[model samples]
Target: MDIKQRILASSCATRWFLFGLVLIGILSLISSEWLVPSIASADEQSGRYLSIWARLATTTGLVVFEVAMTTFLLAVAYLLLTPRDDRSGDVSVIEGSDVGRSLHEHLRTTESYWFKGRSARWVRDVVFPILSNRASTDQIRINLFMALPDPSNVKLMKEYADYRESIAYKGSKDTWTQEIVTTHILAAIVSAYHNASKSNFLNVCIGLSDWFPAYRVDITDGSAVMTVEDKNAPAMRYTRTSSFYSTFRADVEHTIEMGTKLPKPVSSFRNRELDATFVNEILAHAGLSGTLNGAVNEESILKKINNSGQLYG
Candidate 1:
């Protein structure tokens, strides 16, 4: 927004105007508190004209101080009485830079959240913060609907994962294949299970399905936000009252059908570290079972997530 547009924004303009009123009041109070008193206390030994002028200045300053303070109070009252902007059914065209903030704002207020998307290294960026936020709150459930890497769609899934890996900053990712993609999803499950173990509030659930959503959709009780995989398009926010929200909500219901929930991987784990034994359990849960199978080593996946970073969104 340009300076003129910013100055004309209802909230911005009102806030700035309130600020101006407070500043004026503060200046006037300073005059009355110190400057005016000094002048009003001027010595009577001085010329009569000087003393009278001092009294006049001090009196005017006092009146100005009172008026300024009264105006400031009235401005506050006006703000208090004003109605807030009505945004029911309004859809927000969220800029790319604002996606995470928009998501966080909605997530914080969500009673339940539904995230449907394919695997991408950036998935951590989307999920971990909510886990952190939930750590301090009453329990909130985050249901992750991941694209299942089954035989029917494994090739397509691999291509999708490769494309996702391509976009991350250089030296931070690998040319992904079926095993790597599976391992990455495994990492997310591990992360979720580990965090869930640490707190009662971490009600994170992971489900996998053959359905690969075209993009990412975050559905909350009150709103639904969608973003494209490449992020070339802007994010969109749909309020619960909007028709679009119903459509997306229905879509989420449909997408979740036949989904497989996490196998809970060994029933218990005490830490976040990845080891050969832990990796075997993760694969066995995914039905790969016994040894590394085709999956990359736990060390490689660990380095990819820690040093290179990002895993899914």
Candidate 2:
């Protein structure tokens, strides 16, 4: 049956049941001598086991009253304490660490997940374990829509970096310069993809855009998790059945479409043939120089994945 029909069937006479219980409890509490005419109470209920039981209850008086009152109280308490089940398309406003948790849950699922953000550190961290999974190998496809680390946009990236650094992470007093942020953004992307290449079953897609998003969006086929820059602020959660989901999906699509794909380096990495030379070629495809910082800072992040199997931190 549907939700309404099921509700009706389950709660057929709950109101009446509550009403009767309350009335019985009140009547029993009164202990009126005239209302239950003492000895005649035995004669009033007779002839069957149930009637005999009723007579016994009548004789017992306050005991039966206590049971009725307790039953009512317990039912009310149960109703107050029970949590409702999660329904499809429900929206939950969550905050802080919950935002990271929400993204983690979405990406962990077998279904497709799309990510668009500045530095996808949370996404990268969650994706590593999934890439190592042997059970669902080659079954999952993850899309990372990242901002291109084009050297020409370094000036604009500095502005973005300043804005991002202004918001403290976990109450940290540390600071990041524009080069640090730029290298980090570049490192996070390259490290995640290079590591994923080791997985035979996982497919990682990279799409680079010149523009940076104001917020982060991690969405699956059914649910979308979005968070703003303020770590203390609440994040938004929505399902495919919502307008937010539809609009958000469309927005995700448009943003990704605007991106230029970087497939060669990822392909070469998967084939165990990726190097700084090819890395430069990949960057050049996106209008970036491989010598961005003379292959020391951001370019070196790929070596960690190659040598130690550690993600860019």
For candidate 2, write residues 167-188 as lDDT tens digits. 7666554466666556556655
Candidate 2 lowest-lDDT run of ten: 304-313
Q: Give the TM-score of candidate 1.
A: 0.56
Q: How does each model score on lDDT?
A: 0.59, 0.59
True-structure RMSD for candidate 1: 10.5
Clashes counted in candidate 2 amount to 1
Best by TM-score: 2
Write down the TM-score of every candidate. Answer: 0.56, 0.59
- Candidate 1: where are CA atoms >4 Å away? 1-89, 120-123, 132-153, 161-180, 264-267, 270-276, 286-295, 307-313
Q: List the residue pairs that clash in candidate 1.
A: 120-312, 121-311, 121-312, 122-312, 123-312, 123-313
Shift in Å, residue 126, candidate 2: 2.3
- For candidate 1, write residues 26-50 as lDDT tens digits: 7767776877656545643354345
